[model samples]
Target chain A: MKDKSIKMLKTIGLGFTEPLIRLFSGEEPAKNGKLFFKQALLPLLSIFLFIAIWYAGATALYNSEAEVRIEKARAEQGEEAALAMRKCIESGDVSCQPNTLPSPAQVYTAFKALWQDHLSISEKKADFKARVADTNSEREAQGLAPITYTGRPSFLDQIGTSLKTVAAGFLLAVFIAVPIGIVIGLSASLRTSFNWLIQIFKPVSPVVWLLLVFMIVKTVITDPSIDKSFIISSISVGLCAMWATLINTSMGVSTVDKDYINVAKVLKLSIGQNIFKIVLPASLPLIFTGLRITVSVAWMVLIAIELLAQSPGLGSFVWEEFQNGANDSNAKIIVAMFVIGIIGFLLDRIMLSVQNMMSFNKGIA
Target chain B: MAILELNNVSKSFGAGSSRIDVLTDINLSVREGEFLAIVGFSGSGKTTLINLINGLIFPDAGEVLLKGEPIAGPGPDRGVIFQNYSLLPWLSVYSNVKLAVDQVFPKMSSSEKEAHVLSYIEMVNLTPAKDKKPSELSGGMRQRVSVARALAMNPEILLMDEPLSALDALTRGSLQEEIIKIWSRDRKTAILITNDVDEGILMADRIIPMTPGPKATLGPEFKVPFERPRDVTNINKDAQYKRLRNDILEYLIEVGATRRQVSDQKYILPDLKPTMPGRVIFGRKKKKDKVKYF
Candidate 1:
């Protein structure tokens, strides 16, 4: 028995020591590392390849259309037609000109110009601050006017606003939905009575809800006490986002294992204690999954809300730029698209990290 | 004094036309510090019997007296160890045991409570796995955690429902030894519901064979007068142990055969194909199948 105890201690000691040694010494990567990379490589490569193909196709279409229009102009209207086309192209109104898509080179030039302007704005802001101490009157007269030279909201500002709206809507949904869901789930009669209402409301279109919310915000909140646009847009997003969490929480609580309930009964646990210790822990995995789905849905829906409500978010920025027909608009659109994608990905990763921390056993694959 | 008494206990489910009786006219008494094993085939009301004792389920017509008082509902006085090792998978072995200890010993100092829980965990030989969650622990280890959790509560009675049935034979044997050692030390009133005849014979001071449902009832109660701290290896050497074991086995065999015969009668067998010239039959033939002089 003594030798067995010693052996057990040695094994446990090795378990702790091995990881530390690997970390400090930086040995060859573990076998699982190769498997992890193998699993991830295909998806990463496919995404990159798809984007490359799309860029190539768009470039080809634009170049061929431009070539056709130039040839037609040279043949029918003489050398003057060529000059007129060049002016239109320089003016960045390629769509107004007949049959010609803007070349990829034009798009790249527009993107670089916008990027340089954004850098200049930051520099200007810094210079303005330094000059303000010396010549306050002149700077006050010049007063910053929403940095309109860029012709579109910078990629960072749009992403930040979109994220803010999503965060607010998600928090509001969590506050209202989870407790109500739990109550409904715990009582069979209540669940039966309320299920019809949930079913009816859950499948309703977010656009219809958005329109209704806009009307309500317009008529009822007359004092202009808040940004009515933000309020309407958030409520719209929340309306769509709330259902997933509500359904998930209800299912999670309802499916809590009978054995745990029996244990609670045998222990004579108080109602509050049972809810906190047993029911909540057992339901966490499901609840987290629901929250994840809800957050994603809210994010996707928030853009639609922004576009409709003209809310100052990534969605509205993308919409306005698309309508304005500016030279740099397409670049801004691409930037906005990538920003939304990355933010959504990050949100999921954050949730995953939190879920991992909350779980007691690391055995869940 | 009788720690528990069941008088004319009967349980039934549903009502009117759909109503079906599960147990009827059951009578039994358990004295303080007695270890009793209830044995039966599948579908027997043995689990229902334990549930009734634990107050998880109510009897349709009966009185279940615990310490001379009728049980009202599930309470900490009767801690139950479930067959599935229902230790909350989210909690570690130590935490699971500690949870019970904390509830039952609300006034104890934190250290005292910790020590109490740890002692029970040690008794079950799960001290090394104390920090491991149910999902991380082996089946035998998880069951040990359940046992520790129940024992840590220090209840007057421990109700177990086939607690070791899911374990492999070797693990079952080891756990049985551990449980016996713990029972000997505390002498708490314990009622174990199991389908294993050998398990009932090995652990209990008395083994009560139960028949199957509907209206299942105790068939016979066999007394085991083996010496204290009986080892499984040497248990067969005792004449009384052998006699008691054989007796219980005989009752189980008879009950099992009767149940099988009733089920077999319900099944419609397909017409048999003609036997091949080279095929040989096995097992004892029916009396009517005697050939030639036989």
Candidate 2:
């Protein structure tokens, strides 16, 4: 009994005194203290609560407006018209119905069905290729266009194409912009001479660039005959993305500390070493910011180009769905809108993660 | 033999109406392994003289020779420590020193170069903050890294331009001691541009005073007879140190007074505000009134 009491007393002593010991030792306390509350938990909790409030408020507003629209349509169309619309919907002729807006449940169902269709087609294609390889006659007769997967490419395939285009354009922009920007940043005379041209081109709309690019590709790139559509679209998107990197790089170089330049001079650092070691690293954070903005702009322009040019991309998929106006057309359009939004968000997040990694020396603040 | 020589060096700015002479027919020679300090008032062309030595700018007349050969441009052999701590802000202390060592000793192995830089950094007692950037280090620590960088180059002459004037008195004294210690080890030819008379007396083998400009020139060179490894605390007790310090202070005071008198005389409004109003302000004013018949 005495040993048990001693153990209990020690446990209670630690529960109370451990926090004080940790605080004095500069270790974070186990329980939340003023420092912990200010530094870690409070800000995180506040952000969480803010997001929750925003989601709830937006959902409520959407639901109320949707209900009002349904009621008004039913009242105006009369019971007979509503019955005809119900029959048309049951028969899968949704375009014949008066109301075009589908409920959220219908949209979700359509999205799942499309996803399943895409997966099934991909599986079918893979199985067909395997079977053809096993059979000598089938492989010899089929050629490039196999019969097993005869349907049009799915929405996911189109999205993949769109993403590839954006990647190619963004990479090309980076390659072209960095060297020129560094040169312009380093030399005052070059900057003055080139600045006017950059200013004139930066604000020119992507549509204008697209038209110009279309003409150039048609007239100049004649040998072997490139895909004019893809070339024009990618070039337009890349041009739109170029401005941000160039402007940001120049600004970054121009803002490098004067004392560092003096140090470079006194050390007699070579031109290449001075640029790569001193100027480039110093201007990294700003240049990365510019790169992020350029990527987002490229993504936006790529979609528009695909739609206008009838290129195989996510934008083309959306346009095709809108034109179809089938039973699942409205639902498919809503799903595509959400997918676009999510993809854009993911792209931005990736850029942010890369920026954070590059600037690790400068703490998160 | 003189390690460095300046012969009737002069510099001027602008041309025609805007032309102004900064330095005029100045001659000086720095002996081998000697520490020389040039002291002057603000805007007295001391910086211009140092720039000539460093080859950052050229003298309009005459030449500057390093070991009987003229300086073409800034080279690794003449390392300069600027008044402002010029450590590259993006570089850590170790890299800043290593950059110099790597350039000068390019044939050395990587490990050897690293060891060489770290030794100099440790010499300045900055080993603890070797990986910290200039922005993270204190002002004094940044200056210490600059010193380490210059020293790691192993230059024949170390040109310091008031390197400690920006630091607090205590930091300045500590750095001054560190510099003396470093100099005592190798005894490289050094020329310091400073305004502090005591700083000159404490560190230099000779203190040369510079007069003020539109046409500045070296006034006189005072030899310091104090022994090496001199203690700052006991420096005042040395009779020779005291006498040299007093002489430099006296000369500086005379230059200061002369400059003030010249300034006052130059800005004096001529009696051209006609004592007899419409007396025709013609080609030139009469010298009789300006002469002041006292």
Candidate 3:
């Protein structure tokens, strides 16, 4: 059972955990200790090396800039003024180089603060809900519509909103591309006709698609009250992210093993039955790979689209902080950068597990 | 009564000058519960011929008839066990067998269908491996699953395309025995396409040699007079088996020798001396280019 657990961990692309698990199980302490040292310790050491380099570089650059500022103050006023200016930069007073790259500590502090802000927002929301519950009942008694909370979405709420937008766009792309891809893949004439269009539209970047979507959304959706930015961003994401899925699904469907199709034909499966029972199942691995890529592309592009459209999401928060150009804003932006990277990593992992569950070659997945 | 018949069936790929005929002037019939094997080299178009019977493909000329009626497309009446054992890698052994049973025998009660699937799995002696996927099973076990899947459908005819060709010699021999055992009990009309001569003789009631390709055609048939449930150990002692094997092998040798002789007399291209660019790129050979043989 200990051996099996190690195998399972390795299979999930968590090979680093295998050595650790083995060490705990006391199966091969010496061997696993060496493996644990090699796999786990080495990567951690490299990360520390990277952080040390970054910290040294940041401290040197900022101190030099502060020296220049202090020298100018001394030239203009006196030694006391220069000393005070140097003290300001050293103590991390927000007035000095607000847009400077944050040291690791600042980023960590920002992360903690962001969590606290989210927690306070949650409490405020709960308080709002409690206050509204009695009023809502009274309003119902008087046959009036219940009042709604009118507050800016919190940082966590923005993360949730971003996730929702990406999910919506991704699902739409899947529904549109997979059917079209299957039809194109199965028929030569259909593929030929669509090939030119696929070639033309596939390379069009998200930014370009966003501009086109902006025009269409402006003309089509006239209601100013609706969350038009969210809709626009979602549609733009769908347009840009769809090509990967379309190409992969087609390639996968077309290249399904000939023997399998012969088996399907020998079984006298209907066209619909053939697609669902044989084609889809056989092509799932490639399809999921395409979907995972599409989700990542959607995520990378969503921030830009959200920022441009001024949608209330992380993209806007980052953009807003960058514009604010305050000392803490730099650290907050750094925090957002890590959040995006971690979320992208998580999305890929979620897709991998889904692929593993459905695919025949589960271990590879 | 003839359960399956093919008349003047010719299949060719490509058109105009590029056209190559695969099957030509093929007229054949198999009686009910007859075991017919077609022996040939790989890429001999025997698979194409089998596909015609299964209605996996259409003949350019003439027809393939199942019973009195023509076969339009493949159906539950004809279950094919493909050369690759085309079981879905995603499905377990039970699911692979149950896929056919569920589709072809939709009217069967769920309990009845489950029982039927189990019975075939048990027949193939794969009860333990029934929950395992094809990838987990060995080559011999996968072939058994394929056999079990085909048999579970309980079709009027069973078509096998070198189903045991991929297994090792030992496994092949054992599987041949297993197949023979299955045939004796079920007595389903079957066609076995194989390159292995011994395997053909072992499993089939009638062995037909297929001529070599570019365009392959059926040569001659040898009927096996060996009694039912004959022991493999007694094959050497059985004069009929030895005689039949010799006759088929002799016929195949003659066909091969004839084909080689014909190809030898065909037009041959003259070997040109290396061109200026070719000499420069490849570096000139020291030997004098003198070839005057016809």
Most TM-score-accurate candidate: 3
Tens-digit per-residue lDDT, A36-116, candidate 1: 344455567887897677778777776676667777788999889967776775575846443324334545665576567
* Candidate 3 Cα deviation (angstroms), residue A12: 5.5
If you assessed candidate 3 against the hidden native complex, which CAPRI class would it receive?
Answer: acceptable
**Candidate 3 chain B, poorest ten consecutive residues by summed lDDT:** B275-284
Candidate 2 lDDT tens digits, B77-133: 888888887776667889889988877898999999988998999999999999997
Model 1 DockQ reads 0.48
- From the highest TM-score down, the ranking of the candidates is 3, 1, 2
**Candidates ranked, most accurate by DockQ first:** 1, 3, 2
Q: Candidate 3, after superposition: displacement of residue A210 in Å?
A: 2.5
lDDT per residue as tens, model 3, A47-90 = 99999998987777766777788899999999999898888877
Q: What's each prediction's TM-score? A: 0.83, 0.75, 0.89
Error of 2 at B245 (Å): 3.8
Stretches of candidate 3 off by over 4 Å are: A1-13, A67-92, A97-99, A143-149, A362-365, B16-18, B264-294
